[model samples]
Target: MRVISLQPSGDLTLSTDAVKPSPRPNHILVRVRAFAVNRQDLKIGPSVKDAGVECVGSVEDAGGVKGLRVGATVAVLSFGEGGLWKDYCLVPAKCVIPLQVSPATPGSPLDPATWAKLAAIPLTFLTAFGILDNLDLRKHDRLLIRGGTSSIGLTIASVAKALGAVVATTTRDPTKAPNLSENGADFVILEREGGIKDDVRMMFASKETFTSTDELSTPALSTTRINDSAGADKCVDLLGVNTVQDSLLALKGPGGICCLAGSLGGSGSTSFNPIKDIPSGVYLTTFAVDRVDMGKVPLQEIVDRVLERGEYRLNLDRIFGLEDLDKVKDYVEGNKARGKVVVVLPNEL
Candidate 1:
């Protein structure tokens, strides 16, 4: 078997003489077809060598699992210590979500492009879905997504819109507002030089239906109050300390919940004065994709929704091969990719 490992010099190198990995009693072996690169991959330190979180592939051996069989097309969510950027990898049967690509589907004969797109969804979509699900978002709820241009951010916005929520999102880049609105955001608040809190507050104050620069529009803000307060029903904060305080203020007083999912700003120390920062009776929580219970996540329903809408597609910035592991890592680390970067493996291994 072949594997991609981080060398002592902090570069990803390929080794063709690596030994094959066997599946545990509760796991299944997958022949890697394609995998996606995420921001977490960049944070992998030198102490831990191999690094990959998710992939799309076929089951080679099911380890006697009843539902999973050999040669089943599946998406493997590798949340454990093991990496997915290899010729073959072992994944728990519970983490394998079979994609819908039967004869009746539109993309019956799944092409490489479609397979690549499906490969991009698991990690980002699952993370976003878990946070939103925890927040208990209801239809027509005024949902605010901080860091809306990020992969997980975009996924949450699109999925929330599909579920009938009027979504508002923030982005540092004003130009991306149109793109975000077109995808699902009803209102795109530009993160100005000073801060975005005032802009967000003003948007809620007007309670008027307005069109964005991109010409995307939504219904006027409903007069109904969230717990008798004047802000959003819930907020999914992906910017961590950089935006958490403002996010708290942007939510409804007592009943609002803020799910901290990402630290795109900085994961280091942050200052928060509980009395002034956190709203009265507002709940604050954090979410980790790796910590999510696979059995409880609605993976099947999420995939079904994407298949049904066909509008919210994962953007693919670039693709690479297993041997080009160094280039792939460099590309992702550059922080220039607008969407998911994928690595496709050879079929024969």
Candidate 2:
């Protein structure tokens, strides 16, 4: 088994060995197939004190556990320093999902890569669902998908579009328009162009049946010149940089809800006076699946939605092997990946 560990200096030390990980009575054993190198993985940037959590890995070998079997394919979510790059990984029985899926590409059996992609789908999809479904998203609801091209953005856009809500996803570059539009995004804007708030108003206006303002059942649009600026009822901020503050400025007053699934932007430290842009009646929250699934219902409803309608196509931006693990920290932190950057285990798929 092999795993990549990071040092404070930003160098990667790839260590290998066959060590058996202990699974609780409620645990499942998974064989590593394919894993992802996510933006969250770079937080520990070879220079940070203790890079909080590292996001990576997917499918696994089923070690004869209660619900998981030796040949059963499964995907595992690593929120913190989860070790899955090695040949085998262990997940709490509850955290493990029983995904009955065929290979994404026909006639192909579920390998680590396939399983890894499947596994990668859960966490992001879950985060998006919480924002849209759990929060009661509406078709007419406007949305701001910040960090538009991130692995996080891809999943959020797919689900939001399915719900019939017009989506305005923000990307760092304009080159992503064709790809983002194909994924169901109605409009794509660069993060700084007053993205969601500005573009959304124009799009809604263009689709308007009549030019008269009296015809709109909705309130006046709220914006710079519009007096009542139009804003997202729901905003998904994957970049955590000054999140609370930035999102507060983007959210519609009185009813908007902001869900912070990742702190990629930086922490919501309220760098400045929080009251300035903070609107009344807007609810701000940060949550994890463990907390959401507290007990009433198993995640069967959400998981089923993904299995039946889930599309796992990522723009395979780049592929790296064991020897290339060292370059990942630099590549990811530099924000160079065009889409989902994945690393395949050196062994055959």
Candidate 3:
């Protein structure tokens, strides 16, 4: 089967290669209709694998996988730098989530891009909310999201807002603030990119005026954190290295968790004294969505949750065909698109 293979580190290219296409007992063969991109695939520097993951497609075939049939519309969850770019990629059945394959009736406002729009929101939002799920995010908690303009960051902010959390997002681009604000970011900080510790405290503190309102419903969080130097019950960092130290330094007292879910700013040693910068009570964890491999988490429940609510949204940057892959590859590698860049299969699909 022809596939897009990263022949060498940083050399992701499309090449045809023969393969024994089969599925594991718990796997399925997706006749890929569309695949989505995530920042995770773009920034993971080097690995032994041929390419990255984050795809959405259909079940062309199955591994005797139950509850899914051939011709069923579906989306693939790319765990290992996903394989959806190619015409046919075999994935574990657990990673495949079925969408309501049946199309809506005419004039139903049926959008062909519906699945693609929904596809891109998952990888990043899952990474964000899944990490928050670990932290027990409460609606009342002060959540600070840095790098708010990135797809992951924006998705995180959106999910948090939907859950009723007081979400504060930081971005240097003032132009992006309008959209972020519309999506539920209560506080949009025009960040200057340095000394964010105090900036974060101010962002979290800036919302105290609402404290007296009974209409507010938030999750379990310490109200004491409102204006303190150690505010922010949680910090969702989707940019990694550029923001980890500030996240740690800015976390509130006991139970303040810093979730590292991205490497967009590059990886490794951050400048900050763990002992001095991080409060003794603060918790730090590096989260990779793959960590959820062991549980019932991989099922289609979460995917369905987003679709059912109609709350999840994606920018749906552009769509490409399998034959137009060279152009698609160039745009993705160049980071030239605004949101999810999808590869759509031919009409034969």
Q: TM-score: which candidate is best? A: 1
Query: Which consecutive 10 residues in model 1 have the weakest lDDT in total?
Result: 206-215
Greater-TM-score candidate between 1 and 3: 1
Residue 207 displacement in candidate 3 (angstroms):
13
List where candidate 2 sits over 4 angstroms from the true fold: 22-25, 45-65, 104-108, 111-113, 193-229, 241-243, 272-276, 289-316
Lowest summed lDDT across 10 adjacent residues in model 3 is found at: 206-215
Model 2 per-residue lDDT tens digits across residues 1-349: 5666666766666767656676545566665666677655554553433221222333344444556565665555545445555656666654555556666677776555554445455556666666566557788678777777876787778777777787888777788778788878887877663334555444434221223334554456422232333566777777764545566557665577877766666664555454555677776666565464523433445545655555434445676776787677678777777666666675532
**What TM-score quantifies how close candidate 2 is to the native fold?**
0.74
Off by over 4 Å in 1: 8-10, 22-24, 103-110, 206-228, 308-312, 323-327
Q: Quick one: best lDDT, which candidate? A: 1
Lowest summed lDDT window (length 10), candidate 2: 48-57
What overall lDDT goes with each candidate model?
Answer: 0.77, 0.61, 0.67
Residue 3's C-alpha lDDT in candidate 2? Answer: 60
- 1-349, model 3: which lDDT tens digit per residue? 5566544354456666647367667778876555665444444445534454756666767788778887776666766546566667888776776766334554453245665655565566667668788768987888888777776777777778778788888776778788778767888877665747787675555333224322454444414434333468888877677678777777776668888777666676766666776677888877777776523554355555566555655556688766775676678776565556776555452
Candidate numbers, best TM-score first, in rank order: 1, 3, 2
Tell me how far the alpha carbon of residue 248 in candidate 3 is from the true structure, in angstroms, after superposition: 2.2
For residues 35-58, write the lDDT of model 1, one tens digit per residue.
888877656465747767788887
